[model samples]
Target: KEEERLRNVDVIRRNGRALGQIIDDILDLSKVEAGKISIEHIDFDLSELLGDIFLLFSRKAQEKGIQFSIESTTSVPSRLVSDPTRIRQILINMVSNALKFTHEGSLRVIFHWKYETTDQFPRSGLLTFQIIDTGVGINDVHQERLFQPFTQAEDSIARQFGGTGLGLVLSRQLAKLLGGNVDLEWSEPGKGSCFRVTIEAVDSAESSQSVPHFLLSETKSASSEDEIVMTLDGIRILLAEDAPDNQLLITHILESSGAEVEVVGNGRDAVDHALAGRYHLVLMDVQMPILSGHEASQELRSRGYCGPIVALTAHAMVEERQRSHDLGYDDYLTKPIDSLKLIQTIRLHAKDQDDVKRENFVATKFSSIDSLS
Candidate 1:
């Protein structure tokens, strides 16, 4: 049975891999199309975010023996109120693609603050984040279509390097979401490529971002810092997933949050468990074999399963997301499952569920009094 389960998991992995790519394109388009993404101005370290990104891509670069370099300007804001996650995503995709295409030589990523005006809106000075890579640069003719959804430079590139071609499109969409744009400055064949992302700068006052500063203590030494737990603790969660590997991955992530997770393999099972079990919230996987997440959620609604149900899917399109909401899902998560984002989603939805329960309880109590009449 264990071997059979493993074989089934392997098949799901293969299927999920292909479907995952398709889902990525859908989710990216969905987020952009639904206007779900918003520019959140919160204090955070730009360098730390960039460093995290660099650390992430460094492994990939080393695998190919291609030197990956990151140079930041002295003027670059150490702290800023901007969406760092999306920024990281854009760079990772770019760097990953660069590393994939470049068979030889080094890939360098330089960051400098450039105050420039765009032709679209005159007199608007913006700060640009530039990513320059020494790899197989794109050709002139395909440049226009580079940012188009699910389009690569050529079929050969897609075949050579297995990719969905959604990376550039999603990056561009994310840039636009932040009131910025991703532009290809130069792409010379056999040399490399440079992509510049420009965004409106937040003032220094607005940029007083810090990294997880609350954990620091006045009486603490560096030794205590290692002992102090940085993770969230004792979070109770209900996870809905059909794929066994995905379920395990989600379980691992939730566990890192110090969460107690109960897992189900389909949407109906999700709704059933949610209605019957005591859980803080539900992570609903939209596409499932037994019952679609949407249908299960509808059933949950009819059965009065009023806890938070966050839709998790590979599809990143607007209509699909709206449908998730319409079907009574409280929140949405797109795959390749961002770890920090999953935690953030949990925090937000947990708060939302509290608010909802309070409201519902008050309404129910009031209705009981009205019944006396």
Candidate 2:
């Protein structure tokens, strides 16, 4: 049974990841629906965020042979204090929709200044982004309803385009979060659509030292020896799973990697353990008796649990995922969990600490492991 469970990890991991993404998307929407959405404003490089978004969708654009361009005018601010993640989300949803409906023509992204007055060239320019795609465009009648929460242009278009029709709505809401709004500039049916996003920009400060890119590398392959060597070795993980079998499985996986694992059966117990323990990470199950995972997470957040709390759930849907984040969970997971992904998420949040330990380990007598093949 033990060997069978270990061997099934691959299939379990694959299924869990797909479910996880679906859950994340749902949870995001739920948060928005409940007005539980919160934005964190931070100084971020606009170019870096754009570059990441473009890189993410570059492959899709190439597959369609559609032109994807990013244009910034001289007046545009390169740096700004804003919600970078929300901005990226808005861009990705817009671009994805454009590509989906666009079959024959090019897709262009233009970033320029939206002038307020002819002579008043303000220091803070209205940063406007226009996504123009050569594809089937919306009619004048449907344009008004496009940004409405759940309704798309038509049932056929909604089915054909393949989306929950929440993208545009969410994008607009996100724009509002960033102190701006999304407006339909122009659209001609069977031609294309143009979306105009205008946001206020502040003067760019001297760029902060660029941090190294976060490597979101594939972790699909690794021998047990290799995996054991690189897995969480020092981080203490507090796992709140009610299922006895799941708890045992996860505990085995974490302990094998030399991580200190503490398990609880319910949200209330989880909270109690989390407060009492010096944990580096929390794997919280969303549905638990005595107190729901959301309730527990809220309690922890209120008490200032600064460490990462990754939500776990059997409910793999967009609404569920959104609710997890809305409740202040840092990340999420789904049932029949992938031990590797669980570790991966735990690692993602613990990366800063991991990097320091790795560097020091490399600098010391254990440096030989750095170049291990």
Candidate 3:
């Protein structure tokens, strides 16, 4: 009975995650259509990004008894200035589709780049990715409508595969937004398909070296499970949330990471508790009774409460984030919170006093040595 209960819980969690993804996809599509989507160009490690994708799909491929690999066919920069989030999203959608249709054989991702001199960006280039999969390939009739919203290859594929059929639509739109495009290079029914995604990227000033071939099979020994573990042991947090479900959810997430969480339903109580007690961090929900989160945060800041106060809201717009920052919030997080990100945010703001003291001591000793030298 215990084992059965655990399995049921796992199923529920999986379904919840799937539902969340669907909602996020819908919101993203709406933003794209409304011209509200924004693209950011920042220098990020290309190798790290590809490694994350490899780690994500390699295990699934292993489970399905299919080979998976990612290789840089040509000289690829180690870093690039592009929107990593959108890039990952587009690649994930394509790879997910490939995996969904492919029941047997192998899946491979090949990426490379060609430098081009442009007026706006001196070190710009077209970075292309090709996801090749041996799957139940699409025919001509179905291929034509593949990029349409809510339209899959066929009705039977929709029934059997269970998807919203928005992946391709979103992928193409996002790629275009990044000054690139997504295309089906080739497909043969009952054979395989190759998806090509090309996007403009500015080579980072520091990335002069090219990345070497990276193979999934070679990285099998390096456990993807060896991820950085985040903990908030012995930290105190004040949570200001009106919704009972959100309060419960947030509390559970924090307590599981060894944090001491005190929940208050109103902003007034939050202010009172935070002022009276010493808390490492405060999670203030934007909407509440008695006083709004913004009002309470402003009040706290006025009263010289120096601890970090993070805003929580359902709004994921850039204006909303800017408003939170302008209102003196240390950070902003959207609803249906990602647990890992939440933990990371808290850890970043709530520093351990012992660690701080140790760091200070080390710095002092180093300074003394420098003086002697």
lDDT of 1 by residue, 1-373 (tens): 9999999998887667657656665765676777765455444456656655565565555556566667654355556555655676677677767777886667776665544456653423455666776778888998888977777888788777777788888878878877788889999987888888876544345444333312111222323323322243655788888999999998998897687889888776787787777777778888887898888888987886666677887765555656676787766877888665577666544543434322121111111100010
Per-model TM-score, in order, reads: 0.57, 0.55, 0.73
- Model 1: how far residue 272 lies from native, Å: 19
lDDT of 2 by residue, 1-373 (tens): 9889987996776556656544555667777777776666555567666765565555566566566666654445556655666777778778878888987657777776543433433434466778888989999888888977668888798666556677787778778766688888899998998998867554445553322222112222222233213367777888898889888998998898778888999999998988777777789888889988889999988987666678887865546656676787777766667665566556546643435233122111111100110
| Model 2 / residue 65 / CA error / Å | 2.0
List of clashing residue pairs for candidate 1: 23-314, 26-316, 26-317, 27-315, 27-316, 30-316, 30-317, 30-318, 43-209, 44-209
- Per-residue lDDT for 71 in model 1? 67
Error of 3 at 106 (Å): 3.0
For each candidate in the order shown, give its overall lDDT on alpha carbons: 0.66, 0.68, 0.79
Model 2 superposed RMSD (Cα): 10.4
Q: Give Cα distance to truth, residue 116, candidate 1, Å.
A: 7.5
**TM-score of model 3 relative to the true fold?**
0.73
Q: Give the root-mean-square deviation of each candidate in angstroms.
A: 10.4, 10.4, 7.9
Off by over 4 Å in 1: 1-15, 30-37, 114-125, 206-249, 252-373
Error of 2 at 119 (Å): 20
